[model samples]
Target: MELKPLKGQHHVSAITANAKENYRFYTKVLGMRLVKKTVNQDDTSVYHLFYADERGNPGTDLTFFEIPNAGRTHKGTNSISTTSLRVPSDEALNYWVKRLEAEGVEHDGVSTESGRGSLAFRDFEGQRLMLVSDELNKGVEGGKPWEKSPVPEEYAIRGLGPVHLTVAKRENTEKILTDLMGYRRKGSYSTKIGEKQFDVNILETGEGGTGAEVHIIERPDLPIERPGRGSVHHVAYRVESEEELKKWVELLNELRIPSSGFVERYYFRSLYFREANGILFELATDGPGFEGDEDFDHLGEKLALPPYFENQRDQIEARLKPLETKE
Candidate 1:
């Protein structure tokens, strides 16, 4: 059975070595608002920071797990090799080009990819990043901007965009993308990474852009990637309701894909499973959002705890790092 095309991205979770440096590059450099301050749920010793548009909108969320001095990411198969943010137009991308260069950020000059304007760059810790100019899907990002950012809200990244996935093989993953998940075949393009050539097949969500793209590439000769800092931990897809999430769980079971059935993550419910290429994919609910515990105006100001961790708040607080916002 076919599942509904996901609403779009809920969040992209990655790892960073320095909490302070990660906070700086994402907010001060990238100009995203630090919307959430919390600890890793599984291991509360480290910080889980969320950077998004002013409102902490669903598709706009970019989160990090701070693991200081961790080894850099090793590139290979079954990994999200690149995360692209969409800006509205070529002029908006030009704005970023100047900003990155002015800030001494390393970037390749503006170029075109998948038939759209793109600017590629790396964060301080070598996380691959890109800014794509999407005229067709420009205005999809929801919410306002954090007024403090030096970046004019016009050129600020609207939200996450095409995630580039590398797999050792393609057919099974393509089935998962097209059959079970509700992505349509957008098209295919070829590019070279280093000396190796790759074919990227574009897949679009039902809602299309504004964090709705996945570019799947099969790199047959490469070994599997070893995850570390500067690597994407998982990409969470958006679902509208509990029923839709449960439907996805049933579909995964029917397809013989192992899934963690409807796990509660407090702010949003989740079900996790690996795609054929071994990249972890999460189905996350849209309701009971980030504003659940705090008021919209003051979300993520405090170290919010889950119900289980409430009693241990003081201890947990001491164990976690001293994380603060850009403001």
Candidate 2:
């Protein structure tokens, strides 16, 4: 199997201390759609929550695992440092600036980066986030609006944008992403992080759109990151079909890389592996999506369990916290 390039980010999964609070923050504050409510396959005691675009598109999703006592994140190398979402334009970013301010959500002033205006901020759990304007996202609007969302349609987030990864050095990670994963180097941009200035190398999936780009931050001075709440657990790349997924699994084995055997994830099949930098990466199929359990109109309205867990729904629901639906 030849190593295949990723189409774009399928969805990023993080660990959250509280599922209820995480749900409210993403759905109400960010105005995203709650596309799925399920439990982690590895740990049935925890809830796996998915927040995505209105239509539940592949590249538009972000997921979280509910781990109540999970502690704060320690930032360092080999961790997904930032998650960026694409907005329509500079005006769209301006709208968020004001809305975030009115909501008392702390954020940074708009600044230009990689030829686009960007606004940086953090979530309630201290996860780094950024809203950026890019040509690819100019006319892309979220699929459908939650009628009660405080944010207007025009200012709603389009989808996932470039994700940033900080590594001890760029040489090895660059090879894995560019040489093996089929990413093309876009270019480099310089940015300052406090007293020191560093170069951010931009690479894209070559698919040319939202979630296609990845920014690498070289920071040899930093130490390895510890897994905890608010830190990204793994980043998944989208593959169109099972054939493509199989090729990726074979590629990983051929390369002598460790990976979770192809796992059936209900909505989509997936295989997880750790990259050279120790960042967990997954290859996920794009079909048989969120609508598998409930139709579009009723998506995320109730707890959704895989067929294997359907019989155990009662026990699962009893252990989980209640997630409210939009009125």
Candidate 3:
């Protein structure tokens, strides 16, 4: 049976040791909007914070799961190594270079990647990230920048760009991406570490472009990553609706790929699975989004819980550290 292709990225979930600091950095320094403040459904003791462009669009979201006692990440291979955020143009990349410097954020000066300008940087907890210029993009359009962001609208981050995956066994992960997920190999680029150089293969799915691409770096020499604070938990790709997600669940079952079937995330429905390299991947629906329970102008202003967790609000609140998200 033929299945519809997966859309671009839905979101990237990462770990954070401190939700308050994560909130301040992404919202105040990076100028993205905090669209949802909730608890991780699987682990209610920690906070699940969603930051994105104005409306918390599927491909724009970069969320964090707070684990106060989490240790620092020991980075290596078999991981979602770096995530890129989209900005308007080459000029916007220049603006970020200066802004990051002024804000005392750690960043490498602007450079070119895959024929486009990119600035590599790290968050307070050392989470790897990049800001890629969308000046040459021709595929999946970016999201609307928040009008009230501290950064100017033109220079504010618009959405997620290509996500980077570092794995020890490229063929295994490549098979899952190509054969199972329907991603096509677009091309390859060279990356260097010390004196060693490696070819990073590029893959893209529906509406191929920066927003829909994935760069896989194979490093058989490195060890598997030990995830902690600032490490990516998983990367989710977009599925049009709950119906599409259900179909994906069935397809995974037919293929004998184990998955967490049909999870209702309130904002979206999802199915989680691990590919051959043990990297977690989630296929998620696009809607019934952030505005469902809050006014459009007041999203993330308070702790928002899914219907099933609403009854435990008092207990949840008592366990969480108060995070001020109001404008």
Using TM-score as the measure, the top candidate is 3
Q: lDDT per model, in order? A: 0.82, 0.83, 0.94
**Model 1, span 253-288: residue lDDT tens:** 877889998888887889999988788999898767
TM-score of each: 0.94, 0.94, 0.99
Q: Per-residue lDDT tens digits of candidate 2, residues 1-327?
A: 454567788888989998888987888889988888889989988989888877678878889999998988988898999888877678888898887888778898899887778999988888888998864453223344455556787778767888899998788888988877888888989998989889999888846555688889999898899878888998888888888888887877887888997999989999988778888888899888988789888778788899999899889889887777644
Q: How should the candidates be ordered by lDDT, best one leading? A: 3, 2, 1
lDDT of 1: 0.82
Candidate 2 regions with alpha-carbon error over 4 angstroms: 1-4, 135-148
For residues 65-140, could you state the per-residue lDDT of candidate 3 as single tens digits? 9999999999999999999999999999999989999999999899989888999999999999999999999999
Q: TM-score-based ranking, best first?
A: 3, 2, 1
* Residue 40, candidate 2: alpha-carbon lDDT: 96
Top model by lDDT, which number?
3
